[model samples]
Target: AQTVTQSQPEMSVQEAETVTLSCTYDTSESNYYLFWYKQPPSRQMILVIRQEAYKQQNATENRFSVNFQKAAKSFSLKISDSQLGDTAMYFCAFIDFGNEKLTFGTGTRLTIIP
Candidate 1:
């Protein structure tokens, strides 16, 4: 079984600043996908970034970027120029081919202070 860990239960950042959320996982599968998802107050899980275990390049999307450390089995999310809209619960998840469910971390609630 694969497991993800987010040690920080909550984080706070001022607007326009940057904050990085930590994530780590343990998996024996060689081929798999790691992902960061943001769930706002609306309860919708939105994809932030995805990193394939085989890929060396980190994934980035606008203000959201992931520092994917394949060797260390770590995937962290960095949010730049944080905004009020960025306030949400962030989750780290993993999934391998043929798997029907995504194993997820407990979550880290991020609060953006204006």
Candidate 2:
């Protein structure tokens, strides 16, 4: 079974600053996908970034990036130049090729302080 663990329950960052939320997972499967989804107060899931397990390089999207350590089963999200709009609950998810369902972490609530 693959399980994601978000150690930080809550994190706060000042606007225009940077913050990194830690996430770790345990998976025996070699082929899988990792994702970071953000849910604002509206409760809509937004894809922040994604990293394929077979890919060696990390993935980046605008101000969002990921530190994907496949060997350590750790995937963390880094938000650079954080903005007030980035305030939301960030969840780490993993999808195994065998199963289409996504396994998500408890989530880390991020608050961008102006």
Off by over 4 Å in 1: none
Candidate 1 lDDT over 1-114, as tens digits, reads: 899999999999999999999999998888899999999999999998998888899889999899988889999999999999999999999998769789999999999999
Off by over 4 Å in 2: none
TM-scores, all candidates, are 0.97, 0.98
lDDT of 1 at 89: 97
Clash number for every model?
0, 0
Q: Which residue pairs come into collision in candidate 2? A: none
- In order, the Cα lDDT scores of the candidates are 0.94, 0.96
Best by lDDT: 2
Evaluate model 2: give its TM-score: 0.98
- RMSD (Cα, Å) of candidate 1? 0.7
Q: How does residue 59 of candidate 1 score in lDDT? A: 88
Q: Write the per-residue lDDT of candidate 2 for residues 10-92, one digit (tens) a residue.
A: 99989999999999999889999999999999999999999999999999999999999988899999999999999999999
